[model samples]
Target chain A: MALAASGPSERGGGDNLLLATFLEKRENLVLFLAARLRSMATAEDLIQDLYLKVAAMEPGADVRAPAALLYRMAANLMVDHVRSAQRASRRDAQWRLETRVTLGSLDVVSEPAADDALVARQRVRLLAEAVAELPPQMGRAFRLHKLEGRSQAETAEAMGVSRKMIEQHISAAVRRLAERLRT
Target chain B: MTQDGLARAQAAAWVVRLGGDATGEDGVEFDAWLQAAPGNRAAYRRALVLWCEFDARAGDVLAELTAVGAQASARPPAARRSASRLVPPAGRRRSALRWLTPIGGFALAAGLALAVLPPTVLKPATSTTYATGRGQHQRVALGDGSVIDLDAETRLRVTIAGSERRVALAEGQAIFDVVHDARRPFLVQAGGRTVRDVGTQFDVRQRAGELTVTVARGRVEVGSDGSGQPVLLGPGQRLQVDRASVSQLSVVDPAETFSWRAGRLVYRAQPLADVVADLNRQFVEQTVIADPELGKLPITGVIVLDNPRAVMTRLSLMLPIKAVPSDRGLTLLRK
Candidate 1:
């Protein structure tokens, strides 16, 4: 809890003003990046990068709002990270396609252990059953969006319903299924 | 609805939001919701695991669903496109598939869901087992910043639940540095007795059906439910239980019991056999007293456990004894 509040004082006494300020708002930065990146692990990595960049930065800069500058740098880092990840995924997809004919979907599905496979299948069957037992419209929306590959907007258009209505249907359907499967 | 039920419903709503065209604001709100309560995070984690599992098995589940649908109704062509898109032709395969899309947006939340979920869905907890071999000392650092220093020949199983942090000391000893959480009590069950700590540092040792609890900081309650009234122990207090029932409380310097963490065995007028028993745990080669008379000899002073043979040599100098090297261990006899 005191990770941020005490971090600045513990690290830099007075000389490193930027480092102190960064440390002071470190926890806030983590939260902000956590929201933006959607992955806390990636957000943490980005924060570490931000800390390094800030520590090595020139002490005196004509900067207004250090927090804003910090966030701007973090956002740019995230963008770069996302772009690189996308490029990597594209390459990985290309490789998979090239090798697919010989491999024959071998690596596509991970082989769960024998005992675990049975249990997982049973659980999956229960989930499918729960989905089927939902109200017809709600079930259809869930099947189209969640079970199938359709986005909420696409599912809405296919079902001839508003996107908002589809979203409501999905949330309700998921709630019902989770409750049923949990017991 | 119960609080847990509400939390589950909220988690379901968040899952749908994450699945759909979720805005940055929605991500922020979800993060806040996750951090709001431990139960919320637990419920969300449960939901996410199922969500991801379904995503992983989307193809198989869809094939089954389609089969079931065809068996029930004749209208299968209209629903076929959406399901078929999940597994497109090799050339037209989407780089960002179903698994990547949902997981990427909710990646931070997905990691927590990997821990084991017990049968009790309402109070989700992850169980971890920690053990140390002879002459091995280990420090188990928990996610909550609590540190458990396991002594030689120790076996501890920790179950961190929403309501409590529970540990079962099946054998040997461990020093627990419990994180302060008043809402969740840190409890250790050993030798048919339970030791509950309220934000404290304590050492619990259970060897051959005998239990001893020494508190270094804060307070601890030692008892079993419906057995008798539990005794409260504060700093410098120790409680010893024998034969799984009788409890004797005494004043002791907690440092003497906790010194094992520093690799020093400090004893004050303890039996030679008891001292040898502890040494056996700390060394590969065991030490056995040849005669019962020698076993009851009082041992006092510090025994540094850098080397087992050196410890035996030191024991020989301190007492009038001869250390006879045997096939199994060193046998001590009167010189």
Candidate 2:
């Protein structure tokens, strides 16, 4: 089946206008779902599910605002299906994480190539070094919020700062990390 | 700003916006922003890649960060620069519980430790590394009277830091007869899982990618360093964990499992590949399965740690398999 077709010409825009808009914002939707679900892998699957639902849709009349309807369907799908999917995927992810041959102390006989693992380990080291190089406030906020997986409010409480300030620090830290590591 | 820089900045913004407790309206705006231009989407995708990569390797990064933070903390405050310095976060507030402590038993264990500590403080850190080459066996007696027997091709690092007696098993297997110290929790970290004991005799084997912990005497808790329910194993209980999942506990004769200490490799319905792997570590000549299907064949019974050729001959008699000498090692094939 044709999973996707480019947005129809302007004359036929209304037919799959919602799908077109959804496609444009597909990455954003995945990110949104990822935030809610705490897993990008699960978010990606849900997006595919959403795509199937949209693809199988029968041709309909002109829609006034497709974005609103698209999100409505997306939200409904998440409420109905994604919650259970999230739980199941979490258990699956746990098993996956358990089985992954990380660069831990164990000598995994069937692990990835040594060079590949060393490169990834080196990247991780670089990321840590970048985090260490961040401005003190940004570094502390990032260490508490991202690296330590603390809630913004909790991090704020720990650092004796407002949650808004923590958010700003995190945003700046993300920007800085992206700038530093993209190269 | 360069287009790349602008894209990265936009990507970073999206990450924060999407990652935060975003409402439906924020999602709509994000979608609109993504639709407005192809560059936005590409930029966000770039950021997402980094975001996801970091998420996948968060454990390694945090461990490295912690190590760095620990070192930085040891240095004088005036000597450190504020811009590049970072302290441990609040989430890991309880450093004493840094290693694995089984769920529900944390309180009980901590309470026990409180009552067990001596009036005198523990000594400074004394780190030791123990390793055994192929066909070699070594036994180590720690300062605390705990003895460890290292099997062939094993590498283990031991450190007595303050009240914690920690050992990191990098490869191979070891039988730890730990002297119980209520105050000093004996922890063995291997393959992202920790085996913690106050006093116990346990066999921990990290062969290939699988980690097997068999408790012989007393009780020991095995759990992932990541948040999960830690399992407590009693004597005669074995927990076998491959990289992917933890196998159900099998009632094993600790002696049979520990027979490797006496140079006898015992197997009970283990795959031929695993047996071959163990043999590869013990002998200089590697054993390779020519037919992939033959590797899955289950082989049972005891195989003495004799020379590779003799062992392969003995194996050939039991299974419909023959060994051919390859350029590098011995390859097993179906007869």
Q: Report interface Cα RMSD per prediction.
A: 20.8, 10.9
Compared with the true structure, the alpha-carbon lDDT of candidate 1 equals 0.63
Q: Write the per-residue lDDT of candidate 2 for residues A18-103, one digit (tens) a residue.
A: 66767765766787667445567878888898888877776563555556556666666666654555333422122123223222
Best by DockQ: 2
TM-score of each: 0.41, 0.46
Q: lDDT, candidate 1, residue B214?
A: 94
As for candidate 2, its clashing pairs are A98-B243, A99-B243, A99-B244, A109-B208
TM-score of chain A of 1: 0.51
Q: Model 1 has how many clashing residue pairs?
A: 0
Each model's DockQ score: 0.08, 0.15
Q: After superposing candidate 1, which stretches have Cα over 4 Å from the reference?
A: A1-183, B1-124
Candidate 1: residue B315 lDDT (0-100): 70
By summed lDDT, the worst window of 10 consecutive residues in model 1 chain B runs over B113-122
* Residue-by-residue lDDT tens digits, candidate 1, A1-183: 113322223345355555776786676556455433445666689889989999888766444445456656766776677667643332211111211111111223344577886686576567667766888788777766765545678788777899999988887887787778775
Cα lDDT tens digits, model 2, B1-335, are 88767766777777866666555666667776776666877777666667666666654565556444433322223412343222323243223122111112111111111111111112337777877776566656454545576777899988887578899999989888776667678999998899998477789988778999998677899989887899999988999898787666878756556656544566765688888988887777788998888887776555555467767876776577899999877989999
